[model samples]
Every structure is written in C-alpha cells, then in structure tokens.
Target: MSAAPSRPVCILGLGLIGGSLLRRLSDTGGPAFGYNRSAGTVEAAVADGYDASTDLSAVLERARNDDAIVVLATPFTALEPMITSVRDLAPDCLLTDVVSVKEQVSDLVRRLHPRARYVGGHPMTGTTESGWPATDPALFEGAMWMVATHDDTVADDWLDVAGIALAAGSYVVPAADDAHDRAAAAISHNPHLTAAVTATVGAGESDLALRLAAGSFRDGTRVAGTAPDLQRAMLEANSVALLNTLSETIDRLITARDALREHGDVAVIVDDGHRARRKYERIAGSPPEPITGVRIGDARWQEELRRQAHLARVWMG
Candidate 1:
C-alpha cells in the first residue's frame, strides 16, 4: 500500500464515516485530504488539523492520478453525481464508497464509469449520529467491513478497499454485490427500521412506561435515534431487499404474537433470542483473549487471534 509519497487518500464527504477515516489516515503518515459540500463543515474539519476543502476543484487539483484513492463517503443518493463530478474534473482515482447498500452502487459504477476501478464498501459500524463532529477515530475498530465489486474489478482495487478498512481497525468480509444487499437488508436495514418502530411505540406510550424504559428497551431501540435523512436514504435505496427482509420479520413477529395468544410455547422464541444475543456478544466483544503484535501494521493479529479462538471452541468440542 502506498503512503503519502505514493498516492494520497482523499475523502469526498466529511460525515462521521469519512471524518473517522481521515483521522486514521493521518496516523498512516499519508497525505489525507477531506472535502465536504458545506463550507462550515469543511472549516470545522480544517480547524481540527485536517487538510480539508469546500471547493471540489482544489481537492481535485491536489489529488489526481491512478495512484490516488478517492473514497466517496457520501450517501447512496449522492453517489452518482459525485462519480460524474470526479469523471469530469479529476484524473481517474480508485473510486470507493462507504454507502450501506452495495448492489445498486456496484451496478451504477459499472454503468457510469465503465473502466473506473471501483469497489463498493460498507463498514457495519456507526452511532446514531451524523456529521464530522460525531466521528470517532475508533468507530471502525473490530467492525465488519464488507466490500463488493463487479466481476471485472481488479485484485488491487479490492485489496485497496480492504486495506483501508483494516487500517481503520476493521476486519474485512468479501461478498458478491447482490449477496451484500440481501444480507445487509436482513441484518442492517430492516433491523434499524424495527428499532425505529420500537422507539416510536415507546414514545407514544404513557408517561409511566417512558419512566420505566430500562436497559432492554433502551438497548434495543438505540439505533432509532440515528440521523433521520441517512436512515431513510439507506432504507429507500435498498427497498427491494429491505422489503423482503421486512416481510420475513413481519412473519416472525406474527408467529411470536400467535404463540403468546394461543398459550403456545413462548420459551422457544425467548431461548432463540437469548442465544442470538450471546452469539452477537461473542463476536463483537471477544477480540482474542490476548491481543499481540500491538505495533505491527500488516499483521491482522487481533482478528486472526479471535477467529482462531472461535474455530477452536466450535471444532474442538
């Protein structure tokens, strides 16, 4: 991977994801540049000691060539226009995005930039926050960063996306564009909508319920507070897959409701949920028993160690 002298990493949007990437890029001894559409936001990033610009032309001027990597951290809706802008203004940079959906983006990149080196990416990590101010440098740490590409995407292009993710403290997962969308719909998209609904229900409840809202309620519906525009964009952009997931979710909910009403065994549902939560905790919180290679950049010690532990536990017993 190239450092500052090779090709700089340019982030096109300074949202939470983009800003967080910029923060990590700075530590890589690379020339990291940031650009946000809003002047005020750009100024804020600049004040934080990043090379940021509100002017697209300036960002393009500083970063132009195949060596450069331009990460489009914009929303899915803004992707096309940003790609078109890059096409007309800047030299071909390795194009990538941090958008949640992948299949639609993969198709769009293939159609719009026929020969462009593009890979679709989504880091499955974020808070219910927005903008640069909400960015945390360690946000991607231990998160699963999924990367997708068309059939023709080159090895180097894919690695570049994965490398960036790794640098941002994530483990990489590769998938086909369609597979990414379908899986993401079930895990990320629909679940968020469910969380929002849960939150809404709580909000509409009596004051007593509001006061009684505890860990389970708060934890389950935490994502409901996510930036409204961003959440809507993610759900709408991947509506086909999301709708399918939603239908499945609805069916499951109905089954649970029926079980409760008919005096059917509800322990099965509760047990499943309890087991799933434990599995989730093991994945997210268990980062290998003892993290080694603390100073190594290329060795994925943390992820590898934890994965080995998991495999041992599953296979040995």
Candidate 2:
C-alpha cells in the first residue's frame, strides 16, 4: 500500500471524540486541525495548542486537496447537512467520520459526495462524559477501531486509515457497513438502550429502595449515564439492528422466565445464562478473527471461540 500522504488533517468536531483525536495526533506528530460549531469549544481547543476554529470554511481551507478530514462531533440530525456543506467547501479532500453508525452515514456520504473519497469509521471508544473538557489523549488506547469500507474507498487510502488506528493505539478491523452496524447494535447500541431501561425502571421505584441499590445496579446501568442525545442518535441510526437485538433479548428473558416457572428450581436456565455470559466475556477483550463467512457457525468460528475461551482462562488464572 502507498504511504499516507503528507497532507494536513482537519477534524470537524471539537467535542470529546474530536478533542481526544486532536491530542493524540499532536502527541504522535500526526497532522491535526479542528473545527466546532461552538465558539467556546473551538477556543478551548485552540487554547490547548490545537489548531481549532469555529469557522467551517477556515478548517476546510486548511486541509490540502488530498488531505483527510475527520468529522468528529456533529450529531446524526446534523450529519447530512454537514456533509453537504463539507462537499461544497472541501470537494477534493478525502473524508472520514467518527460516527457511531456506519451504514446510514456511508450511504449518505455516497449520495451527497459521490466524487469525494470517504470511509465510515467508529472508534468504539468513549467515556460516560461529554464536551471538549472531557477529552483525554489516551481515551482510544487499546480500543477497537472499525473501518466501514466499500468498493469505492481506494485501497491505498483504506490502509492509511488503518495505519492511523494502529498509530493511535487501537486495533483495526474491517467490516461492511451493514455488518458493522448490526454487530454494533448487538454489542454497543442495544446494551446502552437496555441499560437506560434498566436504570429508568430502577429509578421509578421508591426512593428508599433506590437508596439501597448496590454496585450491581450501578454496573448494570453505567451506560445509561451517557448523554441522552448520543444514545438516541445511535438507536435511530441503526434502528433495524437495534430492534432485532431487542427482540432476541426479550425472547431470551421470556424463555428464562418460562424455565423458572416450569421447574421449582432454575438451575438449567441459570447455568445456560452463566455459560453464555462467560463466553461473551472471553470474546469481549480480544480481537475477533476476520469473519470468514456470512454465518459464523462453522469450524473457524468454533476455533476462534475456543481460542478466546483459552485466553480468558489464562487471564483468570
């Protein structure tokens, strides 16, 4: 693959993701610039020795003809318009976004800027925090970086993006836009919605009972603390996948309930739940092997699953 060009990089959002990327790029000698809608955020980022501004044109102008611009902070509602604006302002620049959902945004990018070089990205890393103030240089360390690409993304440029993830202390993974969104729905987006529901139900109970809640409650509901708008964006962006996962989860819960009702003891259901959770835990921290098939139910899947289980055992020991 060709080396990443020497063109300066511009980030179009200066919130947590944008701010964090700016800091990482600065530390790593990576070309980095930023733009944000909020003057306060832009000023803060600039004051922190990052080249950030509130002017969209100014940021775009800073990017070279072939440079990459990473859209970091815009919400889903604003994304289409922003891409439209960016196309007008930086038509020749290669573009990428840190949006949580890929398929929708990738489709939008293709529709809006057919000539523009673009790839969809989800860093799969963030904290239960918001704003430029919450940005940390190390936030992406050891994170999973999903690059959603298609036939359009130039092979050389795709590798450059992958290299950025590696240099930023992340593992690179490739997935088609739909696959990326569905997997994220199962693991990231759906979990947040469930957490919100769990927390909401728990909070609706008597104040005395809530006061008596423990670590398990806090742990289970931690993702609920994420900004409501962010969570809404994720769910809305991948509604189909999220809904499917939700249905499956509901079915599983009903099955467990039926099992408990049928037998005096729920040992079988409990054992199944425990085993499933353990299997999940094993895969959680490890990189999955490239999905070699449409249905990951074959020997390769079993091998990767067993490898993860062994790693989990070693870590536990």
lDDT of each: 0.75, 0.72
1-317: candidate 1 lDDT, tens digit per residue = 22333457889999999998887777667668888899888888888888898888778666674356888888888888777777776647887888898878877877777767787788888888899889887888767777663444566676676677777777666556677788789888988989988988998988899899999898989888888889988889899999899998888788888998898678767998899889878865765333333321335432443344334221110
Superposing all C-alpha atoms, what RMSD in Å does each candidate have to the true structure?
Answer: 5.7, 6.2
What's model 1's overall lDDT?
0.75
> In model 2, where do residues sit more than 4 Å from their true spots?
1-6, 285-317
Runs in model 1 with CA error above 4 Å?
Answer: 1-6, 149-151, 288-317
lDDT of 1 at 31: 69
Worst 10-residue lDDT window, candidate 1: 308-317
